[model samples]
Target: MLSQPETSEALSGGSTGRALVIHPVSKTPPGRVSNQVASRSTGARLDEAVGLARAIRLDVIRAEVASVSRPRPSSFLGSGTVENFAELISEYEIGLAIIDAALSPVQQRNLERRWQAKVIDRTGLILEIFGERARTHEGRLQVELAALTYQRSRLVRSWTHLERQRGGFGFLGGPGESQLEIDRRLIGERIARLKRDLDATRRTRALHRKARRRVPYPVVALVGYTNAGKSTLFNQLTRSSVTAGDMLFATLDPTMRRLGLPSGRQVILSDTVGFISDLPTHLVAAFRATLEEVTEADIIVHVRDAHHPDSEAQRSDVLNVLADLGLDQPTEDGLIEAMNKIDLLDPTTRLGIAQQRLRNSQNVALSAVTGEGCDGLIEMIDRRLESASRVVRLDVPLTDGKTLAWIYQRGEVLGRRDDNEAAHISARLPEEDIARLRHRQRLH
Candidate 1:
């Protein structure tokens, strides 16, 4: 858990606030930033950090990558380096310093004092984004749980905002219980309560999922790095009006819609929250229920920004997050890759992507903005779903029009033979649908 540092909005500037973004690269062993994907360059990672701050309307005044041979215990940067950056901070009147690295309580507070500005680590910034964008009650609860978990660890940071803010009787302490201890107790109680609520929500979500399973539509979930055009592609395929934007963390809550395939088969297309490098541990734990949609999906579609320079790195990051959720996430028929935003790619890169697709049947280069190659993506999904089905034979009485209609509605009829009193029908259907149909018939 990372503490969410306070940010100041400059009242004088026409913009929201002046923000300084920095990506710290360390060579030493301890406190090294390991969450970053191996393929993403340090420069690209800094650019992403800047974009994250901008997502919340922070006016980035300066950005840079700082090289650190070793981390200092007090400020996480050498005294000279800290002073140098502090000079720049004072010169530019920057209100926020977005550090693209994890910071300890001591390091965060010391840096804030030295720089005379509010400071936040990568985890804190991500949490702030999740907190702001979460719409549903469950989503908001999850964010709060994560935020509180983070705040609990920063009691030693000497933040004025956390001082005497929580109200409670000091029975535990005889006379003068420090504000820090009271705040910690309040946060702990809140965390436990939130866990209870989240557990109940999880059970409810499970029930909802079970009901969806009975509907017999296979679930296809879309996942990718932030700003990968998932919502755009989702709207393009499902004809839904889900909010789509060219911003980071644009879609915080999971959304699902019944999508019809070209084969007359229907599937539930789920657009989930985007993944990012070094996703906070608390967030991963808090949003477990929301991400269960991916785990339960019959087929996962990985949407990639074809134009992003770090697209391959982003793919690796998404896969890593899925792995954390215990998903194998193989690039087999169960996983289809949607190479989205091809319209933003150059002619040469677009052609290269097209050539690359020939080597991988599980991937389709597409432009959600232009409706190009979407049909191929749909056809690919149709084929994968079709391959998962098997043929089953059923006997229905000639008078049972309802059962026959149900079979037709749920499965592809392969063959039918009518005898004197009953109809012998052979049809291809998903295993779950077959079980459901058999269960329905047994109940009748």
Candidate 2:
């Protein structure tokens, strides 16, 4: 059971998805920052809340920022604040009010009573988006598991609806438990089953990743805040048509494609689900299986929308999530920062960006949309992946064209010597190829 103050609010209310987006500007704790995203003005936060609502096709009737301090235990806002929203809801005929703050369960119910509308906090809203966006089987299971965990403790509000709306003979349901107990029992059972399914899914995904490791291609994962041009950069690099959209969470599932570097070396580039500020803890735990791709990656490409107002704050959120996943620091050799979307920047900003990129060897200043500076990004990836591996000398029979061709195809040959009977070669290659050459030499 959640403490009355700390319980995550998920109200069950009357609605047809029409919403009023509200961003609460509350008092900051001592020594804590008031803003999550730097300079994210209350109006901007409210706008983002409206965007979240629109992401799911919700009809946003109104949006505003509500200023509050030292939250009232009963409603999280002052009486005046609640009364103001009540008037807004009545005038706008709003069916839903999305509070852009974590609300206790009690606060949610009180808000609903005062406004005569359904109320949901940020966590609940994100869950709804994930539910609507999840397409793959694993994604659905992950969303369901998170939703169940979120719904578990909020069982207090929706029980009345469950009791009132059913057409069933109360007969052999004999001595049926109260609606609350029934919901608890059903949800408990479902949650248990979802957990089991997700566990199996996690193991299967692990096996798949292990199989990829054996295939000799290093995994380069693209990570950033949602709508950070990851998919755009991925498509530009790999020339594969992946869905890139202008909305948050447009890419919910992790996508992987074969990427060919300028040196003719192939790699597996992965586009992962983006991170966000105030991400629900339930989601973090639930999506761990999918996010293991980030942990297991050989390289992490931090894609940033250089034009975004909250770019730095978004970067902080991504780093925090990475740190939480046990990656305290990105690999120095394999890390790259693609300051993408430069096409959207002004000339002065572009000059500054160029100077910044010059300071950081790993930084790639590229506009993924216009195909600018992409070759440099590829070269950066190649250099980083190569720095760890060393070149080796090898000898193959002159008549063994197949073996020689394979070596040329898989390695960067620095030099080759031709003799009547054999060919000597010096090539930059991984140990896997070196071993393969030695095995073939023995067989010959």
Candidate 3:
């Protein structure tokens, strides 16, 4: 659990006070400031920080990028910069200061005291968003586990009661336990229990995957940076009613649906939590069970917001996260790129994207909002799946309409001939479907 004064209200949607979002650009040579992402500008990073703050309903009164030539160990910012923000906080009466970087426990505490406001770093802000956006039981568990893991390291005795000692139960007791120790112990116990529950969740997910394999439909997963229109594209592809919005971390829970391809074959389309630059490691580990839906997907779609200025940087960030998840091959060669939000692009840029798509069969330029070029994406998927299927011949009784319909729905028909007694059919199908058809024949 988070300490009440530090994060209880801020993370639980109780705090609606004014906030100041700051992005610190580090100066490597003591003279030049550089953005965190090599291709992204400083303003973009600050904008993202502000967006993150607003995602949790924080009333952002001010936002800026602070250049740091050298960091002070106590505050992670130069003394003058700290004093400058302190004045801004006082002037605007800001109740919260969002630092767009990871802060050590001491630095976080010192900054809060200096600014006379609650301070949460990037990790904390992201966690707060996750805490608010998580709706499912599993999502809550994963968020809680990640939150606890992150909070464990920042136990800097923020409360006065943490220093007090509890009396031992024994009469001739030696030293009693301090409140901080008790809190740490309790948090540790909760973490252990959560890990056990998550392990069970992982096992359950594995079993579900196995069951899906039994009646196998190729799984296609949508993955990209937060608010890159993955959920929107998912809705467009599968015709689902999942909540899709233009907010960061808008969709936390994984949603799956059955989708019919152009070839009349079907697939399982999965919309998963979006990836982001500098996504907390604890979150990546804790949400392993949920992300397994991505790792196990037969087809991976890398969606990009082509209209955004930092599009290329966001692409690199998403690929970095995928690499961390041990999915190197997908981003390298196997994945399909969906250049989303082309409806927002100017005609010249959209034309360029169209030309790029003509050069690469795996690249698709589409707008999930207007449903433009989405058919092209579906056709691309259909062609890929068709190329991977094997042709097989089947003979069915004229009376058995069910099996014939099943074959037609599950495979691409190449040829068919009807006789008085039976129908001979040739179709392209997956090996799993072929085996199942053979098994169905044996049962009769």
**Residue-wise C-alpha lDDT for candidate 3, range 1-444, written one tens digit per residue:** 223343323322223257889999877784676545678988888888988888866789989888887677889999989999988877777767889999888898788667766778888888878876778889989988887787777665332222224311110111222223226787799899999999999999999887776465778889999999999999988888898998888899999999999777788999999988889999999999999889888788889999888999999988888888888767423478999999999999999998998898779999999999899888877777776678888889989988887777666677989999888988777667788987867222
lDDT of 2 by residue, 277-324 (tens): 889987998999999889888789999999987777778889999988
Candidates 1 and 2, the one with greater lDDT: 1
For each candidate, the alpha-carbon lDDT, in order, equals 0.80, 0.76, 0.79
Show model 3 residue runs off by greater than 4 Å: 1-16, 30-36, 157-182, 331-333, 393-444
Each model's TM-score? 0.83, 0.80, 0.82
RMSD of each: 6.8, 7.6, 8.1
TM-score for candidate 3, residues paired by index: 0.82
Off by over 4 Å in 1: 1-16, 27-38, 156-182, 396-427, 431-444
Q: Say which prediction, candidate 2 or candidate 3, comes out ahead on TM-score.
A: 3
Model 2 misplaced regions, further than 4 Å = 1-15, 28-39, 157-182, 393-444
Distance from true position, residue 192, model 1, in Å?
1.0
Select the stronger candidate by lDDT from 2 and 3.
3
- Please give the distance, in angstroms, between residue 417's alpha carbon in candidate 1 and its true position after superposition: 11
The CA lDDT at 325 in model 2 is 88
Output the better candidate (1/3) by TM-score. 1
